[model samples]
Target: MSTVKMISLRVKSMKNIQKIVKTMKVVSAAKYAKAKKDLLVARPYGTSTKVFYDKLDLKDPQEQTLLIAITSDRGLCGALHKNVSTKIKEEFAKRPENSKIVCVGEKSRGLLQGQYGKSFLGVADQIGRKPPTFLDASRISNILFTTPYKYTSGKIIFNESKSVVSYLTSVVSVFTLRTLNAAPGLRVYDSLDDDLLQSYLEFSVTSLVFYALKEAAASEQSSRVNAMDQASKTAGNMISELTMVLNKTRQAAITTELIEIISGATAAKKDSGV
Candidate 1:
């Protein structure tokens, strides 16, 4: 009877844990729905920007390439962070050892610091929270185009096959950097004459950045949702098992009491007969 009581107590504690897990699962699912919606909304803007960039015929005058990899600040959303980090690492491995990195998220910061250390340059944690203005984009663009980084010193070789305009557009849109009023150091490309192309480039880059952010956010939410869902399922299963055990314990206690009562009654009857 005492053993049965202990089992019942354990079952009750398990039920409480199950309830908490179920609640968390629902919360995560709700977050996932919101994140997914945001991501879908940003996709069209990103796609349009890419299309505009594809129409441009810009050429690069400089040699070094600046790769900006975007990620998330916090990671509870499963392998989303890991996937982006892995892609960045693989890309980094293909580049020259002197390549510079501009990271956008905390996850990127941590991963880059561990992998490339000093190679990482500017890191912006607030990029996702607020969309960057054109002025900010111009500033970053100026630094990349005009500023003489240590890596590009030796006889810089320009790649004529690659469109510099497209590259710039992709980076800008993907990062969501706002366009500046007075564009500086943008005349390097001979083919870039139309003001509309330049404006489009800026817009595209900003949109791309927004899109990337949305995707990352969605990934995070999805991961959390899946994790919570699994947890909830596990909790439910545990609850069911505990309930069964509890019922069995109660039945055993009742059976033990009944047996004791029956035995005592028989003993008394025999005693009376004697």
Candidate 2:
């Protein structure tokens, strides 16, 4: 009886847990859809900006490099932050000793802070609490720009969404000081004066940052949904197993009672006959 009761309780608890996990899976799926939509909306502009940067030939002293890693504020997604953190550290390791760390979201901040100490320059949390926006990305880029460090170039590490439910670790380049801005004759278009060029440069940075943040959010949601689905399945399997056990125990108890009753009746009849 105790075993049956214990199993029953366990199954009940697991059912409750399964419900929660299933709900989360649904919620994350919804969020992922929204995030993916936003990312798709903004990706083209970011891609164009990246192409523009690639065409520019600017090589500063490489004196100060920045490593911006996009992670998440919360964690339920498996190895999402850890994979990005590992990529960040690997990039940081390959850079010049003067490189600084910039983390987007809390997870990367925590993971890199202890390792990099003061080298970790800036960390932006709550960036992923809502679906990413152009304004949010702009604000983050502006914050990085305002930093006292004179970084010539930057590398952004993020998980790029490869498919609806898959992501791959990727890096985006930032030529903070574009050579075209400084040279009037070499400017691709005469309409872009120094101020206009600067503004466009900032926009480029923002766009890139925006892309990274949005994609990371999508990937994070995908991972969360996948994890929750697995959890729900496990819970369901446990419940089914326990239910089977309970049913078998119940059958055994019924069989035992029938045997006892039949034995008692048979002994009474035999004594009557005697």
Candidate 3:
């Protein structure tokens, strides 16, 4: 039976849940602001690198490809992680055997580690626990450069935030030093050499990864803000509905008690001939 006490309890629980949701929304909003600010600063550096590569029109001769999938360890942010995983799956479909994956969060590692375990070169976990720094990106790039696996072409996959409620999964193409050296456009510059190109490659990878991390962080935070906002609103609605139900139940009980008392009093008066 639906009673006033039960309904009141449900309403109290809903209120508590709503409070938590609101708090989460506030925290996410602050995080989103910081992430967005960082992203703005990183955009120019990352874009310039991509533009330089585009002008060179470099192409890899081999089919080997590498992918750095960026995501966050924490969940509760909509499809931020799933989108990256999906993009990786699509890439794998195109080149299943010659592809390698470097997962940059626990979420991606957990998602792809099952079937793509063999394809994984490394996993970078606990990334979203704090704001990403250039040093952090350098560490990841160092790991990649040290690995025995070689790739002609590579991509960094991450979420690009548009608004608090909107985001797009994006990819940044990368190339090896060999491919850069082979570009015909590079012949115009007589000052370049193998060592310089290698250094540029390392710095380029680090910058791109740093940019991607900032973007993913911003997107994740925005997505979380939107999610928590919606959750808080839903909880508010539930609390309102539960409150109404409680009031109706309590009134019904009171009305029933009053009717029983009136009936008993009338019967007694009639029996006593009053």
Residue lDDT tens for model 1, 1-274: 4476777677778778767766766765676577666656666765676563344332332344456665656655455556555655665666656567767667778877876767766665654333333454444444444435543311111111111111111223221112221234344435654576546545555455556555555555556566666766777788788778778878888998999999999999999996
lDDT (tens digit, per residue) of candidate 2 on 1-274: 6566777788889999999999999999999888888777867877887776566655545567888989988888878899998988887787748899888889998888888868877777777788877787877897778999878778889998877657898998775655445433446655656677777778788889988888888899998988898898898898898899989987888899999999999999999997
Error of 1 at 151 (Å): 9.5
**Candidate 1: TM-score?**
0.58
Q: Which candidate, 2 or 3, has the higher lDDT?
A: 3
Score candidate 3 by lDDT.
Answer: 0.89
Which segments of candidate 3 are over 4 A away from where they belong? 270-274
For model 3, what is the alpha-carbon lDDT of residue 224?
Answer: 95
lDDT digits (tens) for residues 1-274 of candidate 3 = 7988888989999999999999999998998999998888999988987787888878767688998999978998877899999999999888899999999989999989998999999888879989999987987787778888878888899998888789999999888887787899888777888999899889998999998898899999999999899999999998898888898999999999999999999999999996
> TM per model?
0.58, 0.83, 0.93
Model 3, C-alpha of 103: deviation from truth (Å): 0.9
lDDT of the candidates, in the order given: 0.54, 0.82, 0.89
Alpha carbon lDDT of residue 36, candidate 2? 80
Q: Which ten residues in a row have the lowest lDDT in candidate 3?
A: 54-63
Q: Tell me, by TM-score, which candidate is best.
A: 3
